[model samples]
Target chain A: MSITAILINAFALVCLIYGFYRDRDKAVKSLKKAAKSLFGILPTILIIIIIIGLMLGFVPPAEISRFVGEQSGILGVLLVGAVGAVLHIPALIAFPLAASMLESGATVMAVAAFITTLTMIGIVTLPMEIKILGKKFALLRNGLSFIIAIIIAILIGVIL
Target chain B: MLLAGMFIVALILVSIYPDRRGAVFNTSMDYLTEMAFILPAVMVLMGLFSVYIPEETVVKHLGKASGSKGFFLAILFGTLPTGPLYVAFPMASTLIKKGARISNIVVFLSAWACIKIPQEMVELQFLGPEFMLARLSLTIIFVGLMGFVIEWMMKRTNGVIDG
Candidate 1:
């Protein structure tokens, strides 16, 4: 396993042991919750994996890069950002997908825009947000998030 | 529903293009392996946080603080590996009802949406430390500023936000 995997697993293990020592019932409950949530999200996970597989398989790196690579520029970043806002995939799964895109010749700006907008702006959840937080607050937050996501993407491209 | 559609689509595509099947399978396997190694651990950490850090605790802490301290607490509470952003919506509503500052509520909600601790670890695993750290810091700075801006705009409009 990679060091990242090892470190994350070790951290979870230590937390588990500590929790068990502190309260056996709560620890076991957490384990059950973990398993339940894992299963709950499993189908979406599989779907994402399949999508990634197809994307990497069918699309040549050159073609992939041409749209989202260095030459793609600001337009590419905006396009991916808009897609990210519309799609409702879990953020946990988005990282690996972003990594795959990066590996296949996507620019840092595009990937950053995609991930930032994916997590920060939720066009899918706008109705619910409006229902709970009012339209103005929801609109402002989402609208501002899209703008910042673009800015963040550009800044990441510059700095990294 | 989407899962079923994906599977059917994948099957047909692979069968039609036998030459690309190996590439597709290999890519999927690689990602599946990576996910297998980290997802369970990430889920466990999330479960533990959800179980231990009650929503009540978050509200209690976030509702009381003010000024810079409130902003710090908001980010701290928001970054905990708890439930999804939807879960935070109601909590934020509750905080607002309790008279928490609008800027702090915005900060808390934005942080909950992004910059999550477990989420960051996953990003680091896939995107490397340089990419993840840069995004994280940039996100924090901008989200912080956005919070104040939103609050200011709402204040200027005067009672425009009535959820």
Candidate 2:
């Protein structure tokens, strides 16, 4: 367990003690509600993440690197950003893939786009977010993320 | 198209016989464990917030036009935060449950996921100082802008969960 987990555990214990002493019924009910909400969604998120991982495993690095390496400037940045929007690889997975791509001569702009979108945008999570937060909010948030991700990439490209 | 069709069928099947299938059953268990561990803590945090962190503190730090300073602060706080996104989801849910404004939770989450400073430091070792700095600047700008947009949209819809 991480320090975070330990801290959370300690804090939870204190809360539990406080709640149990103060209002047992409310404490128990709140915990149950929290558990129910977490359980309800975890399965779907896990399945989706696993599916994404499997799909990512199939793509060839050379193809991705070549495209990113193209000297098409603004278009290349935009394309990379679009790709980032659609993909949701975690940072752990993305780093290694990016390292290899960099080794293979992909441009910094492309990798920046990928990393930004990989964290910021969520094309795969769109359906889930839409269901949870409603369509308009989810779309607006994601749409903005997509645009900002590109701008971020280009900014990184110029500054770095 | 084929994948989409298959996913739709799968969703239907899960909804109908959610527990009958082994994969779905196991998945549900994972979800249960995740929630069991996280939710209580989130509620306590909410309760703690009610007790501790002043509303003025949140408002002053998290306000829409707080600019880069607020954004940087948000990122620093966000980076130190550790929990599943679900933890934030529920806290945000419960904060809205307890009359916290939509903008607060929205900004909290946007910054929570985006500007994790510690995570960025680790990332910097690999991505380089220049890339890390640039990403940081951009994320702060983007999340700050997002907070304003979320607030505006909430007002327009008048359907924010907050009361």
The models' CA-based lDDT, in order, is 0.90, 0.57
Model 2 captures what fraction of native contacts?
Answer: 0.17
Off by over 4 Å in 1: none
List, residue by residue over A18-64, the lDDT tens digit for candidate 1: 99999999999999999999999899889989989999999999998
**Candidate DockQ scores, in order:** 0.81, 0.15
**Ten contiguous residues minimizing lDDT sum, candidate 2 chain B:** B46-55
**Prediction RMSDs, each to the true structure:** 1.3, 10.8
Could you give candidate 1's per-residue lDDT for residues B1-163 as a string of tens digits? 9899999999999999999999999999999998889999989998888888888998988898899999999898889846668778888889988888888998898888888888887898889899999998998899889999999998998845688
The digit string of per-residue lDDT tens for model 2 on B1-163 reads 4446545655666567655445544544543353344434554544443333344454444444345564455554455454333334544454454555555555566665555533453344446667778788777777777767776886787666432
- Say which docking band candidate 1 falls in: high
Among all windows of 10 consecutive residues in model 1 chain B, the one with the lowest summed lDDT is B81-90
Candidate 2 structure, TM-score to reference: 0.55
The deviation in Å at residue B156 for candidate 1 is 1.3
Error of 1 at A126 (Å): 0.8
Model 1 gets an lDDT of 0.90
Q: Note the residue pairs that clash in candidate 2.
A: A39-B31, B79-B116
